[model samples]
Target: MILTLLDRLNRRRAWLRWGLLAAGLLVAFGLPWTLYPPVATDIVCWGLFAVAFDLLLGHAGLLSFGHAAFWGTSAYGTGLIAIHSGVPFYVAVLGGTAAAAMLALPIGYLAVRRSGIYFAMITLAFAQMVYFVTNQWRDVTGGENGLQGIPRTLPGFDLSNSFVFYYAALPVVLLGLLAAWRIVHSPFGRVLAAARENPARVRALGYPADHYKLVIFVISAFLAGLAGGLYAVNHGFASLQEVYWTTSGKVAMMTILGGIGTLWGSLVGAAAIVRLEDWLATAGFEATGLVTGVIFIAVVLIFRRGIWGTITHLLRARAVAPVPQIEPHLEHDHDELQPTPTN
Candidate 1:
């Protein structure tokens, strides 16, 4: 009876986790219709971008400082396609994401060979190379000025309206989030996590650690590129600033602020930082960098695990009810077993 009861309790816990996740998704879907719709939509975009960063940094234990390469490349690619081809917005976005992934394959292959700070430096250097290319290739790239007048269309849907655009972007963002969640929960994710924890041990088990890392790097790049494409459409332009190293560093800070390994935490951190910066700027704060830096330091010092981690920890602690001790027992047929015991 006790075993049966324990089994049921475990099942209930699993169901509850799924239930909470569904509720969170529903909230995200409804957010754009609520107050501050534009801000909410922007939050969704940055959230998706941050999740991509977390995928490589947190899940794969790969620190990339040149992720802006993917982000900016996708934005520019999508913007150019939108401007020149008059293609459907979604198709353009996909093209952008594919371009970013293709770029990641060669770059990530070389960068993934080096771990720690060297890995980060390789990514940074590669990003700088990309930036320089965009700047020097003035005729094609528009140099420092960036690509302007990018089309913001939703195909059959009339996306000239803000609400229409918000709804359109919301579904894509949700799909991206779902994909990220699925990837992180699969067997691939387990192997990736194992690789991160101990690459030597994982290789000893015959798993190709480098291959897994490269795959994840490409995946992360693809998603970041998707977000960048969406960003271009949302703003109706693609800028060189999108590919800057500072932008990459800001993403790293956002991910760390929200909870390095927690996917949702990255989103939360991005939203918080963006909103806070917006508010501060409106309040005559010219030195936003100084304020943000101080806050980042404070967050790192106090909430090292980030808001989601802290919330989860608190909730779990609150749920720590006393567990009842169980003792084992056996029942036997007295007549048959008693004779054996006596013997």
Candidate 2:
């Protein structure tokens, strides 16, 4: 009886998840109509960033303090490529993602050797180096001023308009999200889960745990770079602030606030944070960081599992609760009602 009840609950939970996904799709497609086009675009870009960070922090069990290196580098690369090469916007974004992967190779090679805080420190250190390089390379990067007038174009269409560009660029973001989902559901993803839980056991099973870690790190950087490139194009500039440590920290906050291991949760977290910042800015609140930090602290202390995680936990708990046991005679009556087979 317990097994049967669990099975039914499991089915119900699956249906609920599917329903949520459908609703989420509807929201994604309709958001631009309700919100400012630029804000809607920013939400999607930040959502991608959060999802990328979660892949590394949540699934790979690695904490990085310097993902801004990937994001910032990609932003600069995208702007430079478009300014000089005059390639299509999507092509430039791809170029930027590719460059981020290359940058990740050496960083991941070194960072994966350490775990815990050491790993984070190494990434942070490398990110600082990248920031220095970016600041000094004024000829290309535009130093403190940043690169402005980066074009967003498709041969025939005028994508300079924010509204037109948001829809055009959205499909690429969706494809990136789909790629993440596929990776998480793949066999390699199982190995990542095992490594997250028990690295020693993964090595005992003959898997080169270091290789897997490096691969996922690069993959995460690629996704982040993709987001950064798109962001620069959408805004028509690449700013130095994109490479700042706070940007990396912000994405981490979004991932944690949304439920780190849940990809959709990352999007939810992004929307919440982005919208809050937007609202604060519009209201002329100067201490945006203070307000955001206070709310983040409150959420962490109250909903330790994060918004999505806590909600799902409550649902599962209710599902597993014993239904009032059927009356004892009800079972007996059901057996009596069953027709006996003739021998």
**TM values, all candidates:** 0.89, 0.92
TM-score, cand. 2 vs. native? 0.92
RMSD of each: 7.9, 8.2
Give me the overall lDDT of model 2: 0.91
What TM-score would candidate 1 get against the native? 0.89
Candidate 1 Cα errors over 4 Å, as ranges: 1-12, 320-343
Ten residues in a row with the worst lDDT in model 2? Answer: 334-343
**lDDT for residue 159 in candidate 2, whole number 0-100:** 92
lDDT of each: 0.86, 0.91
Predicted candidate 1 versus true structure: per-residue lDDT over 1-343, tens digit per residue: 6677767767877887899889878878777666366677778888899999999999999999999999999998998888889998898998989999999999999998889999999999999998998788888778888988888765677887766787888778878888898999999999999899989989999999999999999999998998889988888888889888988998898898888879988888888888888788789899987988899999889987887778777776665444656454435447654656431
| 10 residues in a row with least lDDT, candidate 1 | 324-333
